[model samples]
Target: MTRKLEGQITIITGGARGIGRGIAKRLAADGAQVIIWDIRPEYFDSVAAGFEPIDTMAVDVADPESVATAAQTVLTTYGAPSIVVNNAGINGPVVPVTDYDFETWRRVIQVNLDSVFLVSRAFVPAMVEKSYGRIVTVASIAGKEGVPGIAAYASAKAGAIGFTKSLAKELVTSGVTVNAVAPVMVETELLEQMTAEHIAASKAKIPMQRLLGIEELAAVVAFAASPECSCTTGFVFDASGGRATY
Candidate 1:
């Protein structure tokens, strides 16, 4: 690693486990002072054991108040983060749209989509003032090509992608880049939220006939979060293993 993010402050939401955890480690390794905003900060110690210490704050990214408070604390303590990864999300129940519980649908949207808006809004001002920033959202292949059983999850992710593009354009001249990474199914604890049948179906869509690796996804996110990715904003980097046509 070239320490491309040296002297930068980075934040990763949902950094306690799964894809978020992997990204957190990668950013830390890349020489950013990494801070994790997760609902389960208890898992932070375990994730930080062999690496440089990472700051952790218990945060419910979906709640406006929680995000506001956390954002205040970070700005007060560490100044504005130069890198923000909107990786917190939930895989809503695996059910058809007609059978989906209404409350669950709202909850999914809140966590996966609404949080992106709140978190970005909170930190972007400081980033604009500083004249440098990177925002990366962890989206999914389901966002681009819908999945049958997870309508809520898919819809929220699609919204995230759109939000990234729109925000990127809004900040284009401000030196703040907004982008997203859309990966195919990865073998993470999130898989526990899906049905065995759903898992099989998802894997079958990939020409590679395999699940994406956490490290692979992390690598893509690292680049998007780095200064080297200077020319691209409002772009969705694909990690679909030949599954994506566009």
Candidate 2:
């Protein structure tokens, strides 16, 4: 089979587990040299070992110094990335806005929104110089329709969608494609952070009557990260089963 990403250098953040890991596996299988960036170094060896030729780096995507240093290290070793997946995120604990923890809200925004800006800031210059790149950001359906309890998470994801659109436009003439995949409640460890009531409430909203599968969402990520996605940018691909009526 001819690989769409043959010899492509790909970077997947939070690739040690969950939806990020699914994206990493699919990208690596498609012949990209996948480099994973995750905060947990302990999971690196095992998670990377599952995919052929995939390497992992300990990176706190939200931290500017960590992102800059990690980007430098990755460039030195793997050259510039042709494909970038901004998948590192957290679904902050579910709580009503009145009772929400301020620090947790900040942390959620840091990981889910600020990291997108920081990662693009760190690596996109190289991509622009090369005049070629694919950027895929992981968003959420909650961003489209705000959920009641997870205000911080919903806000950050909405920001991610906006950021993807703005960046895509900026890179439209630069040979770089930026798009976002917004998935309805995918089955992942992040879901564990929510209360049972919250999880059930979210599922009830999905027209599919079920949570998305990780690989199912990864399929969209793979497409968005391929050179074949040439003409589309600033677009949000909804993988929310039948719930996305708009």
Best by TM-score: 1
TM-score of 2: 0.96
Worst 10 residues of 2 by lDDT: 44-53
Superposition error at 127 for model 2 (Å): 0.7
TM-score of 1: 0.97
Task: Write the residue-wise lDDT of candidate 2 on 1-246 in tens digits.
Answer: 878999998988988888888888888878899888999945755544467545778999999999999999988887889999999999888889999989999999999999999998788988999999999999999888899989999999999999999999888999999999999999987776779999899899888899999989999999999989999999999999899866
Q: Could you estimate the TM-score for every candidate?
A: 0.97, 0.96
Cand. 1 Cα-lDDT: 0.92
Q: Look at candidate 2 and give me any clashing residue pairs.
A: none
lDDT of 2 at 21: 82
Highest lDDT: give the candidate number: 1
